[model samples]
Target: GRNEKISAEARDAILARGEELGQALAERLPEVEQLLAMPGADQIEVGKKLRGQAQPLIDEHYRTVLRLKPRLAPIKAAVFPLKRNHDQLVATAKEVRRRLQLGSEMRTVYDDTGAIGKLYRRQDEIGTPFCITVDFDTIGQGKDPALAGTVTVRDRDTMAQERVPIAELESYLRDKLRG
Candidate 1:
């Protein structure tokens, strides 16, 4: 399910971007043709301008488009239990990862082998955009009832943490990735 959906979305996005590129070049075709129809000196001047300015713009545009692609994203998110010892927390984390995978085509990972800090670092090294940690708070074992069913979502680049309810986690991640 995820494999097919992700691959299809990836294909469609690439094709759409490619079409956009083609249209962009087509829009400039008339101008290029007019420049080429001029005298040899004018043609040389136009070529110089294109090489110095237009080519760099096109290259940058393509790079930006490529970077924005979701399929190219290594891991959509990482899931970790606060510690490996707690069976319940670990199970919750696994379920969270499973639910996220079901909701979208993005890749999800579950890790319960290390300390939370180390897990976060590993995820960062692997280029994961977000890390979700399930702790006692997630299972209503904590004093704060308000934190029940919520996980700590950490940003890879920023290392920022936000508490997000399990029910909304997938949609929140999708929105964050989209933006």
Candidate 2:
């Protein structure tokens, strides 16, 4: 193989780009260190940055948390069935919640009363980050065969839903809450 040397201009440009990156990192290093230390003031700032959810809740018990991240919420996740009256759905929901509690050791709730919308609102009011629903698809009743043995995870802030395999539910939630 033949060796080629860079032009002086190209070399200088590379050096300048390296310097810029180094300076940017140096300026941000202290901020990163402070966040790692997480003092009261820094924690407050972080809380503010993490609280992206809108709307207001009248419950004073969680009003302070309404300004913080879902990870900071007392109840990290809630499990429910799409239809509370369905016995199989309710049982699966309870087992799923219990498994999450044992697997992650996080605060998890099971709700079988009222509509799914109402259940979500109640969990959101308490600052819960995730709501996992055991729907008909999860129990192999849906047309999609691949959906069996999976649950729907709903994000509290965005209300976005995603299919997650029941076997991986604990780890999936653990990674999400870590942020």
Candidate 3:
């Protein structure tokens, strides 16, 4: 099951950091505007420059929070079946949620291709970068656990899917989420 206490702390830290950064950006809006209007660079160049300047602030915030407590980062990915008729999908989602103690923030995508887009949007909104989906292809052709093997793990940022053995799912997710 989800660890309520740890999850709450993590959520609080993420929100607090976001608010702090928002306020800092607001205060610097004038300078940022000035920088944008200063030179011959195009909008894309200006954006790149701004992003370079902004990266350190983001890094600092991330480092501080992670250093303070690492478990606060929410689930970086989620997997659900497209069809509601599949009990496997529901069961997987429930288990994942319970294990992560994710509360109600986890999203379910009813369409396979659409899942990538939805996951990306959510990741942008919440600063996550990965999502996974278990489909018919994942279970192979067997109903038995011994026969059922690899699962499809999707990368949110790259939109890549690889067939990973079922036994490696948990550890793989942990490593990806940690990284």
Worst 10 residues of 1 by lDDT: 60-69
Ranking by lDDT: 2, 1, 3
Candidate 1 structure quality by residue, lDDT tens digits, 1-179? 12332345554444344344445664565444444343341224334444454444443333221122344577788899997888898889899999998878978989877777667767666677788989899999998999999999987656689999999998898889887
Clashes found in each candidate (C-alpha, N, C closer than 3 A): 0, 0, 1
In model 1, how large is the Cα lDDT of residue 162? 97
* lDDT measured at residue 96 in model 3 versus the true structure, 0 to 100: 49
Q: Measured by TM-score, how close is model 3 to the native structure?
A: 0.41
What is the TM-score of candidate 2?
A: 0.62
What is each predicted model's overall lDDT from 0 to 1? 0.70, 0.71, 0.48
Q: For each candidate, give its TM-score against the true structure.
A: 0.60, 0.62, 0.41
What would you estimate as the lDDT of candidate 1?
Answer: 0.70
Q: Ranking under TM-score, best-scoring first? A: 2, 1, 3
Better of 1 and 2 by TM-score: 2
Q: Model 3, stretches more than 4 Å misplaced?
A: 1-72, 96-120, 141-147
lDDT value, candidate 3, whole model: 0.48
On residues 80-111, what C-alpha lDDT tens digit does candidate 2 reach at each position? 99998888998999999999898876999998
